[model samples]
Target: MLLLLLFLSLPPLSAAQLCHPNDLAALLAFKNSFSNPNSSLPSWDPQFHCCNWYGVECNDTTNRVLGLDIASVDLHGTIPPSLSKLHHLQRLRLHKLPNLVGPIPPELGQLPLLGYLVISWTNISGPIPSFLTNLRSLSYLILSFNRLSGPIPPSLPSLPYLYAIDLSRNLLTGPIPESFGHFLLSTALDLSHNMLSGDIPASLGNVNFSRIKLSRNKLSGDASVLFGKDKVADTIDISRNSFEFDFSKVGFMESLDVLDISHNKIYGSIPKQITEAVYLQFLNVSYNRMCGEIPTGWKLKYRSESWDNSSFFHNRCLCGVPLDPCK
Candidate 1:
């Protein structure tokens, strides 16, 4: 009779407690630390429940926070540690928040159900958290336009279902990880405008991609590493780097639509392969140490500015087409 009486007295677990109650309190504590200059996040009042807060959504059935979408809110201050409390969170969007600063909390990797994470255009610095690889269910990740630095994490290739990745406009350095070849289903991979150095990873030539950008870095080596067996569409910008190679030897040059290798140290005669790229719309090999007869082609005539530089002066051995024949 005593055991039965004790069971009857215990309070049942409610759906509101799907996750720990302290999770809610933690988010509230974070709000307390920052100054909301615009009063835009007024929904973060202490008296009201978190479910009523702006940019936060809860599942109706479990009353658990499921989504946090705060794009372009001009929100300033560091990301709150309390967010890890939302164990059921599926989407976290915090784009265009220029005032957002500090490293992304590695604790965020604990969200098992997270699918979409967009934190672009912030001032967040430091290496990408390795813990983020724990989000096995994530599909879209955009960390573009930030102050993130360090080698690209090799673990990123483990994300089997990832479709798009944009890490452009940062201070990331180091060779492209060999594991990047594993992203067979990826549609876009943008690593442009970083301090990335070393030869383009040869493994990249094996993976299929819709768009690839490695422009404006200190990357070196031949251009042949990009053209895999598959036909890639969109742009290829390796421009503004120190790539040194014989353009005549490049293999499978027909797949690209836009190829820009300007401002490099490349040399040798333009190859006949240039005419084979029938779909080529934009080609800029200007300001390189290239010489010999210019390859006669459909679009080559219009790219005068790309080829009219003093570097061509050293190649006095020969020239023709748009340029005065070597005196």
Candidate 2:
């Protein structure tokens, strides 16, 4: 009996806690599909329990695969469809694997418990599958910096729990969807650096996103609606687009930290009320069709960051402390 107690106390059986064999096979199959040029996947050998493998996590009670994060590991190859066999997976992040190219397998949408799915900065291309709208448990979805093309999937907003989405720096085209306003839980939505066009959806004004970035696209239309009475987003960057809206209608925002709307067709006098935004730290309205004297309060009182003469340059007409005094 003393020998039995000593054996039990030595160190609770480590590898003897067997994981579900099917889950082990699924993970082994996932590792087998990738060509590991940097030897980043050495620990994924099938000889060991999959739960002990690098970048794989399993439930303590059920021993089912629950998470897989193979980010920035120089992994190459398409995401294996076998990963869908991880029926209990809740989080999967495959970020910054630049050499990993190919379409995301639609089979991945089958992971019923997936709550966080991020596949950023890779070479993945193709339209985002519309079936991802059924991921009821998803709250954070990031597919940024890929080669993905096609309109933002119209069915994407159907994920009721989704709160943040980043599809930035892709090859996507087409207008922002009208249903975007329905993402009531979203606080951050970035669709920047794509070839998107068409009018900004007026409905976007209804959503209370705290950060919205629609910059470096070909979007056109009056943007006054985005800056209208709802006034929630604190960081709004719509610069480098073809949007047209007078500065007068760009209402005051008390919470604004950064505002960039440069290189557009916006024309009109800079609104003096813009100075009322004490929280404003960064403002870029240059390279537009704007004209008239710069607001004195903005020129003298604002100094959150260093400004170059170019910040006010290239306007249709302007004069003030920053621009040789409107003569």
Candidate 3:
């Protein structure tokens, strides 16, 4: 009788929670923010469990919204600031939504756990908000192929964990902030196809990038800082700019596979050290002011696959087998 009484005194176990009601309400508001989301979100039935809804993921134990991935859908809406309600949201991706317009909502700063945030290939406009620095956990921030304008925030260096940043194909102007050089080591930096003008910051030489592209901008000055025998950059493209640097003195890293300094005001002969870069695959030195016989080496010695006359054309005077013999 004592054993049975002890068992009867035990408290009843409660079932684990469902998606937080507030989180569910936030998602519903996000759906309503769109003018035409019914067809795209057919599975977002109010009666069903939000964890089972399309493009929404919830934690297995707490049943709280954890991730939201909605790509290539025909939803026409600004990112609803209400999304901040998902206190545990970690990944938020909204890609290839061509009709989606407006600026990134500032309320995203409240999501302290947000790490991966992508809003690419859409029509989001306006300056990238400074509030994004509040995302202390941000790892990858890609906002390419949009119409964002204005100078890049100088405070971006404050994000302690931000690694890869892609703000390419936007309308951004002004010199790249010197703080950009403080980005974590080997960060992939792409600020291409923008109207950014002024000197390429000298500070950039301090960082070792995995790949760096500043092409099709109005940038100028000594790009030589990016090159050194000790540097480990894998690829560098500063093409279609007014950059004037002495290519003859610049050294290449063995890791270099692609280098495009074409259509610039750069002078000096192609350095002989380029021969040491066996990983070279794509090269375009055309339309520059460089002169002298082209350097000969593993990849440069061959006149096929972009080592030919066309690659060395339109220069003041370049000789050797690719052109006519130096006389």
Candidate 4:
């Protein structure tokens, strides 16, 4: 009768009890807040288990929710704070929810296990929550293409494992934190297409980013740190800024493939150092105050069409293989 008693005491494993009661309640609360016209959560019914729901994943042993990815689902309405109840949640992606408005709920900081948080292409606005710094396990964070404004929280760089941050195409203003160099293993850092102004932090050169896009901002000053020695950045786009560095600084980027520093106040001759970039594919230094001969790099040699000519045009006095002779 001991085995019979144990079996009788076990919870039912039917569809009626598909998920942990607390997780189910949280999911229901989350679903109730959104206007899901497409019926993305048709299976999100109390009669069935939440583990079987459209965008939910649960751990097999403990039955705790582990991942929730409802990206690009046309989810409208603010994120429900009840989601913090899922203590086991490790990866949460709610990207491209253009209709989801309002500030990111501070309740997200309560998720102790969250490692990857991607909420890009949303209409969420307000200052990035400082509580995010408390989430030490966070590694990949992409909050790009949103209406989020205010200076990026400096506490973010202090996150021990954070390796990627993309806040581009937003209304974010103010200087980028010099502490950004603390992301020792970061591969990509993009803060482009914002209203951010001030000198590009020289400390950014300390980290070895593979791609750095600070284009179309109001940034100015000596950007030499970005391309100077120890820079392992391969693709860099700082175009349409007020940076006044000489073109010669680009020589250090031997691994560069795409370089667009156009429409800046940069001047001086197109130095031979740039030719050292054997991997250069796309080069646009146009619309600047640069003068003298275009380097005889293999990529710039046999180019045709006005677009090619346009790349070297609008400068003070550029001539050679690409453009017509200096007059």
- At residue 289, what lDDT does model 2 achieve? 92
Q: For model 2, state the Cα shift of residue 155 in Å.
A: 1.2
The reply for model 4, stretches above 4 Å from the true place, is 1-12, 35-40, 299-307
**Candidate 3 backbone collisions, by pair:** none
Taking all chains together, each candidate's TM-score versus the true structure is: 0.75, 0.89, 0.91, 0.89
Evaluation by TM-score, superior candidate among 2 and 3: 3
Q: Candidate 3 lDDT, tens digit per residue, 147-186?
A: 8999999988778888788999999999999998787647
lDDT of 3 at 187: 82
The model with the greatest TM-score is 3
lDDT of 4 by residue, 132-184 (tens): 88788898888889999999898888888887888898899999888886675
In order, what lDDT does every prediction score?
A: 0.75, 0.83, 0.87, 0.82
**Candidate 3: 10-residue stretch with minimal lDDT:** 297-306
In the range 1-327, model 1's lDDT, one tens digit per residue, is 999999999997553444347657665665664568337477776556677778878887766778888877766688777677777889888888888899998778888898888888889999987788999998888899999999999888788778778889999999888888778474578899999999877777666667788889998877566653355645677778888887666654456677777788878777766666666666677777777777666544233344443323444253765566655
Report the lDDT of model 4 for residue 41. 62
Clashing residue pairs in candidate 1 (N, C-alpha, C atoms within 3 angstroms):
286-306
Candidate 2 — worst ten consecutive residues by lDDT sum? 298-307
